[model samples]
Target: MSRGAQVGVATVYRRFPIKEALLTEAFAEERDRTLQLLLDLVRRAQEAGALRRDFVLEDVGLALMANAGIRAQSPEVRAEASRRFAA
Candidate 1:
């Protein structure tokens, strides 16, 4: 649950209708962590003069498509990934 504490299904389902909703909620923290890792890597590369200054959003998107787990997901997932990366 959002409280980060374990609770029974009766309590959880009282809030969420389906299991996927709960999964998506739980996945949010993980997604944030993954986004932070990717962003840190990109920022470090830029700071270290390894990433080109002219690199644009498309380049970042390609990198995510190549290296991120989002390659297999749908457009909505890609949009979420883009939003996460942009954050």
Candidate 2:
């Protein structure tokens, strides 16, 4: 992976003791950024009266939990499930 990224393997290993550790950190950082963006959008929606004032991050987390199951479906089913889920 480091070679594909054009970085030295030693440099990658120096920062992350194991490849799994590196992937875990990367995914976590991405998840945090996405959550922040979602929170901002939810806040703006609530301010505009589009979303209920009482809605919270836990509600979004629940929605995400439901959405995760959609990935197990076939592609066509997944697409339809995702559309309905978003709705």
Candidate 3:
């Protein structure tokens, strides 16, 4: 997770119309890029026998949701949680 995730998520949840429109496009493009990158990494892992060939994109979504569930009392704490989560 990124350090700015707390702020970003808060912004998303607030749903300001103008900001939402811009953020929507920005996040959509970023999501596409991230998805592709993940797909590539998964493919590489499969080729290296680190992951099963049957692994699919839906599994990635589940993993991401699990990661996003992390929370903490402070930004610093949350950042630490994210780092540990990535590890």
Please give the RMSD to the true structure for each candidate, in Å. 10.4, 4.9, 11.6
Compared with the true structure, what per-residue lDDT tens digits does model 1 show for residues 1-87? 435667776888887789899899979999889878877887788889988767654576676565565553588877787667655
Alpha-carbon lDDT, every model: 0.74, 0.86, 0.80
Global Cα lDDT for candidate 2: 0.86
lDDT of 1 at 84: 74
- Per-residue lDDT for 1-87 in model 2, tens only? 565778888878998999899999879988999999999999999999998899998998788788887774478888788789877
Candidate 3 has a TM-score of 0.49
Poorest 10 consecutive residues by lDDT, candidate 3: 1-10
Better of 1 and 2 by TM-score: 2
- Superpose all Cα atoms of candidate 2 onto the true structure and report the RMSD in Å to 1 decimal: 4.9
Arrange candidates, best lDDT first. 2, 3, 1
TM-score of each: 0.55, 0.57, 0.49
**What value does the lDDT take at residue 54 in candidate 1?**
73
Kindly report which residue stretches of model 2 are placed more than 4 angstroms away from their true locations once superposed: 1-6, 67-87
